[model samples]
Target: MKNSSRRRVRPASIASLRRVHSHGGTNNQKQRSLSTGRIGFFALLFVALYWVKLGFGGSLSTSSKAANSLGSSAPRRNRAHLSYDAEEQVAKHKLLPEEAQIIRTARSLSPVTYDKVAMSFFVMYGRFLLPFYERRPDMKVLNIGLGCEEDISARLLRKLLPKANLWEAEERVTCVGSEIEGLHSLTGDQGDVQVLDSWIEKSGGMFDVIIDDGKRHHNCQVLTSFEKLWPQLTPGGLYFFEDLHLGKSDDHRSYSTPACDGSSFVFSDHIKNWLDDIIYQGGYNSKKWELHYVFCQAGGCAVAKEPPGTIYNKPPSPNQFDKKQMLPGEYHFVTTAETFDPVTDKVTTHSFFTMYGRFLLPYYQRKPRMKMLEIGLGCDMNYGPGASVSLWKNLFPSAELWEAEYDGECVEKAVKEGKLDGLNPLVGDQGNNATLDSWIEKSGGQFDVVIDDGGHHNCQIKASFDKLWPQLLPGGLYFIEDISGKSKPEHLIDCVWPILCTHDLHHSGQVEGL
Candidate 1:
């Protein structure tokens, strides 16, 4: 708001940019036709589907500033030949040193956009990084693996960006890295997949830069986790994947075994699988992560994500959400303390989990007498009592708390402990299709909120979703906690999260974790 002048564009340039963006382009791809021997019908269908998805996803030709993507069919360096010498490229680009540095590394690359004019694809980290880098602190960062004792990158970032605000909540930066023990002790948490995921989930929001060098061998897990982490990151964030060449040749992890010629990722390839799964794909993730630039220098790769716009990166409000109303039950509910205490009704929940409570409280509070379904009831009866049953009982005194617990004894225990007031419990295997269907049938398939705090396993999570999501009412919320891999909440069929985040500048309803 301080300087609207900076955003101003000349009318002619605006029109030109729009024209360039609107132009549809077909990539000059090598494999225009698949080499299907005799039967080409299926192959034709496959080709048609591929193009259709591309059209849905967007193409380099028509994408905003996409003429420079590695996959673009732009006629600049490729104005014809798929090769470029430094001098020739310099002459062709009439470039600066920084621009020349990019050209040098991008010469032999394919499936990338090429528009030296827009500098879209195959870009260097240093070029785009500093331009967008802030000196202030509070920028949360996650650097995996970099296994350096000195933490040279973190130190260098500190020096490049101004540090006058690191101490203030609005100014400080928090960078957490985790890795295996090496000659240099990494300051990060140990590079365990689930542990890192927990840390990311606990961080409660996305990072500005996520550098993953966690594994030298098998990187499939790392990339898989990135799916969850990337959504957490602010739009236009930078992501780095160290040692991309390992995917091409490293046998320790069998990263990739197919021929290394210019082509797409073959099956079972880690790095390529990552690219294939995310980029050029259609989904909320793809819509958010347009490739700004990429560089494969010294066998390592650094990529910049396209700006997601100001909307996705809105910061949490200055005033915290009032938790007094959503209290003691909220505490015992979150902590999993088997017994609920009415005397300590004024218990305070931690800010970390309260973020979830903030957005969730408003959902159920509207209807005091609402139907709440929670899958994966914690604590077995032979051992202990459950949390959600008691929490919901106290939190929503007038509403009914529906639970889907897998064990018979747990339900029996709850019945004995006098914990069954307003609590409707279902005892069945959460992972079983029959059980889920039976539960839906019994409940008449209606719930105001569906919370999956149950089996965090991928298959079980998805199975519960497939069966139970349909039961949730419109404008309802479905939450999956402790999820480490791909769980596309937005991609869920017919599930609409009406208020993902409120526009109330002071009170944003940020969905804490997926």
Candidate 2:
């Protein structure tokens, strides 16, 4: 008892592990928080949009007089406009003594709030854009109508190239129509340019880079007027069009389902036509400024005027997935295996849904025998012959299939035609309780998989997922084909977070986890 041996010390409690170094891993209670944060993101998205809709009206009014020249007369070979004092404002932050001291102290402590709302997009923008800023001394930047539409693009550019002068346009009037405001607005029609010439004249010189995000309605005008903008750009500048998901400024909630009845994608058709006609219009010499590099995503696109300088010796890296993998099924459905028209099918579906299939293929391949449901029979006639329903049926033969569409007659025809082995379509609102109850009762009260390729409206997405996802068999997957700019309901996790933060452990509303 008197002998002193080294004692094993249990230094901390289980609660201490939970408290220290919080915010990562299983020990953190953040799973509950993240689950609620799901609801919070939707709250934030709707709040962000609602707040933007109600208050974010932008008009570009400047105190300076309108200049007829766009700094394109000739390249400046001198330091005539450079000032050390102005450069010190940003390049060398001459913060006041008190502010500098505060900043030094702030570096050692954890931030009270991480209100980094803009960091996500800024990270994405900078990924492909930093190279442009690096070569700025030899560049002239023109941001067409970026005045108020996307102030961040200009702000980012300014930060990236502090010394460079950038010319941006203020919307004075609608580009094509008799609309009072020059700002982009939601309208039934994609407005034509009525006063585009005025803005072009007022802008003065040509630009090396043009961002055509001025007004949503004027996308057509900007594409057609590339002849005007391209001349302004340096021999190898770029043209960017942001917020391409929205067809117009006014509409925030609809997307093109690219089934190609007759009309083409509004922006796609317009831009392609312009690209084809650019040679006839002139100034875009094919050999000199190759219209070579075009980059597009869910959000927008960037078209480069083949680089005159800074050539990369190495080829780009290989991609992880091929875009055309899902196209075969999509093509077969759209073409009815009849026309052999892969080109039209590719244009109609694009690669948007392929991303969903890419992620879901694993879950699907593993569970080929699970019961499945496909909502929204495309407008293929209203009786409900949706391409997704057809594709899923082919993908999973043994699995039972169910289809829902608003049009009962279309569903009846498909059922009569023995589509998916005579499985009669479940025709009703995908969001309705009665319809869901009837379907659940009819299909033994559960589905192993649910794919929401439905109306794609915000309300419909929320309603269908909220009401039905819990009915999914545990360990099953729910695949939703989401539009890039639009929010998906169950993205936070497979489960939609209960609005009430705390609930009874066994409440009837509670569902099994994914």
- lDDT string, candidate 2, 1-514, tens digits: 0012212133232224324423211110001122232222222211111111111011100100000111112212122212112223223322122222222232222321011111111212332343344434435565554434334434444544455556555454343232222222222121233344444465555566666655433334444445445666664566776544444332421322223221223453344333322212121223433553344432345666644431222221112122222222222222322122111111232222222322233234445566777777665522224444444444455677777777787666656555435343676776566776777776674676676666644345555665665566543445544322132233222333343222112112111100
Note the Cα lDDT for every prediction shown.
0.41, 0.39
Cα shift from native, residue 475, model 1 (Å): 1.0
lDDT tens digits, residue span 1-514, model 1: 0111122221222123223433211001212222222111111211121221111111322322232122323223334322434465344332223334444444433432243222223223333443234221345556554323433333333343433111101101133332322211223222244554565555554677666655342344345546656676675566765444344333423442222222343212333333322212311233445543333332345555644331222222312223222222233234332234321111221122322332244334445577888876665323245544555554566676788787688677667766665677887877677998889888877776777767544356556755665666643556654332222333222311321221112212222221
What stretches of model 2 exceed 4 Å from their correct place?
Answer: 1-347, 380-384, 420-424, 482-514
Q: What TM-score would each prediction reach against the true structure?
A: 0.33, 0.32
Model 1 — TM-score against the truth?
A: 0.33
Q: Which regions of candidate 1 are displaced past 4 Å?
A: 1-355, 381-383, 485-514
Q: Candidate 2 at residue 18, lDDT?
A: 27
lDDT of 1: 0.41
